[model samples]
Target: MSTGTLYLIPNTLGDGDEAALAYVLPAPVRERAGTLASYIGENAKTTRAFLKRVGTTRPIQEIEIHELNVNTPAGEIDKLLKPLLGGIDTGLVSEAGVPAVADPGALLVRRAHERGIKVVPLVGPSSILLALMASGLNGQSFAFHGYLPVDANERIKKLRELEQTSRKAKQTQIFIETPYRNKSMLDTLLSTCAPSTLVCVAADLTLPTETILSRAVSDWKKKPTPDLHKRPAIFLLLAH
Candidate 1:
């Protein structure tokens, strides 16, 4: 019997409105998303909402959603792929952006590859890639350090280290913070990075209020710090 494929689905960066969905995701991805009956996601509520927006024909209640998060045990991850082994195609989705890139879905993807199940990644909006495209940074060579330390002092130390690495390797550093902590993160970046270093703050990406600005750290200090509180954003920094 042929094993089922594991579809890596991508969701919107911010509000999953019709316009953003229509603009970033291709027609084929939406169509394929509708056909899946089982899925693994970071959050069930948001997963259902995204499925509805993608025009799923299946009844929302009937769709099977297995939760996968930081707390999910590594051993239990194999069970999440059992449906695929039974010849039922299953999708992996995140609360936002592409699944598995910076999300816990990567664990399931890795297990699928070990089991030799076909894995397919559908085209969708990714705040990281979108920010990099607009940041005009060293996209060819860059690194994504998911999230910095939450402690202010540690965060500052980490920021300085990332800046030093960027300068030494000429590699762009990309990172993010929880929406509620956005302002604090921005403050740390402004205070810690070198004055001449280039920094890009891409907020509310793929949304109507989307903003992408790249400027020298010195310039950012002169203007009012952007109000990023309670908003999703991607921060990019480069020493060159």
Candidate 2:
């Protein structure tokens, strides 16, 4: 009988390491920290810390760290995750929020399924679902378009297309961009979508000063917009 396990880990939202210990494994597994596997990014320090909280005193070798790339091919993802999938349990995590929801764990999960590996999803905060919950938009039918294009002209064209598609399909179009580019994306949406279009901006999600506001495209002119560079944000466009 071949027995292996993969634990999907979620990074704490906003709060620091105080709650991390609760998310780790028990004492003896904590003693086998080195045997644990970590599937996170190089810049994912908070996530790495959470894993260490579980592994405890385990040897570093047991603590395998698989560097995941959101843009990589499935074959490449399989190559990087071979060991964890073959014998050891793999832990998939995003820097924040649940893995595979606009995170890099989709390929891992799909590959694991193809290999007949058992998978488990843990409880955690997901910025997307949280935003949708608060946005007051149609949550039943929504699509996450991931990050938008950086090129201004192309972005406008794509937004126009999405606006039409969203309206016709009766689906909410959700997307995000780099924090620095958020303002520009907002501007494009305002200019591209119909004046009656409903747009929602969910900024600094899960933080102390979280903001989830939905308003008409024409009404957006009535209030001050987020500086975007000051904080991270996600945008949702709905047809109402």
Candidate 3:
């Protein structure tokens, strides 16, 4: 039997903003997701919600869903691939953005490649790419550091290092912070990065409340970080 293909699905950035679904996701992606009978996702509950929006072809109860998160052991990923190995086409999705990028499931994708299972990625909104596009940064040579150190001092040091690297490499350094810590992250970034360093804060991407601001650290310090509290955001840095 031909090994089944694994589809990498993209989830919306907003929290249950179903209205934005048609705006960010293509019809082909939703159509393909609705046809899949199996899925692997970081959070089953959210994945179910996503499928519901996609209007799955089969009854939701009949579709099979498996979990793959940061907590999933490396040894267990192969077990999750059993269905695909047996010719069951499956979808891989994350809580937000595309699967296997910032989220878990890269291992599953790698394993699929080794086992000869085809891997396909569907098009959708990715906060990282959206932010970079709007930031006017050096997208050609950029690196995405999922999340910086959480510790205050450590995060500051990391920001300095990223800035220096950006200057030397001419590469855009991108990172994200937890919603609740957005203000603190911005504060440290403005304080730690050089005055001329270009900083971008893309918040609430793809939603009606979306905000994307790119400016120099000196200009950013002229005013407050703009109500970033409890909002999903991506930050980009390009040192001069």
Candidate 4:
């Protein structure tokens, strides 16, 4: 019997707006997603909603969705791949964006590789890649740090370290913050980095309120900061 394939599925970055979903995801991806009956997701509710949007032929209630999140123990991750070992292809979906890239699904993918199961990643919108593409920063050499520290002092220290790294290596540093803490993160960035450094803040990507702006730290200070509170955003810093 052949081992099953592990499909790394991607979901919309923003709220489930049909137009945005249609524009970002291709028909082939949606069609394939709809055919799968077994899945592992970070959040079950969002996973069902996404499956429905993709036109899944299987009844939402009937689909097998195993939850994988930060709370999931490393030892139990291997059990999640049992369906694949039994020759049943399994789909892995995250709360949003691509699975396993800065997402909890990475653990499952790593285990799949160890078990010699086929791992396939489908095409989808990644906020990290989209922000890099539009930021006009050093995309050729960049790093995504996921999220910065929430503590004020620790966050400032991390910002300085990233700034130094960006300047020394000419590599763009990409990171994110919780939606509600977006404004506070922006304040730290403005105060911690040098005035000449460039900061790109891409907020509400793929949504009607989408905004991607890259400007010097000094310039950002001169203008009124955009209200980013309660908004999903990606931040990139480059010092050339």
Per-model root-mean-square deviation over C-alphas? 1.1, 3.9, 1.0, 1.0
Which of the two, 3 or 4, has more lDDT? 3
lDDT of 1 by residue, 1-240 (tens): 889999999888877577779888898998999999998998899889899888887897899998999999999998998999999999898888899998888888989999999999999989899999999999899999999999888999899999999999999999999999988888888888889999999999988888888999999999987788888999999996
Model 3: lDDT of residue 124? 89
Q: Tens digit of lDDT per residue, candidate 3, span 50-133?
A: 899878889998889999999999999999999999999999998988888888889999999999999988898889999999
Best by lDDT: 3
| Global lDDT of each candidate | 0.90, 0.71, 0.91, 0.91
Clashes of each: 0, 7, 0, 0
Tens digit of per-residue lDDT, candidate 2, span 51-100: 65545346544455766765666668667556655676666767766777
**So what's the TM-score on candidate 3?**
0.97
Q: Each model's TM-score, in the order given?
A: 0.96, 0.82, 0.97, 0.97
Greater TM-score among 2 and 4 belongs to 4
Model 4 lDDT at residue 105: 91
Query: Candidate 2: lDDT of 149?
Result: 81
What ranges in model 1 sit over 4 Å off? none
**Candidate 1 overall Cα lDDT vs. reference?**
0.90
**Model 3, CA-based lDDT:** 0.91
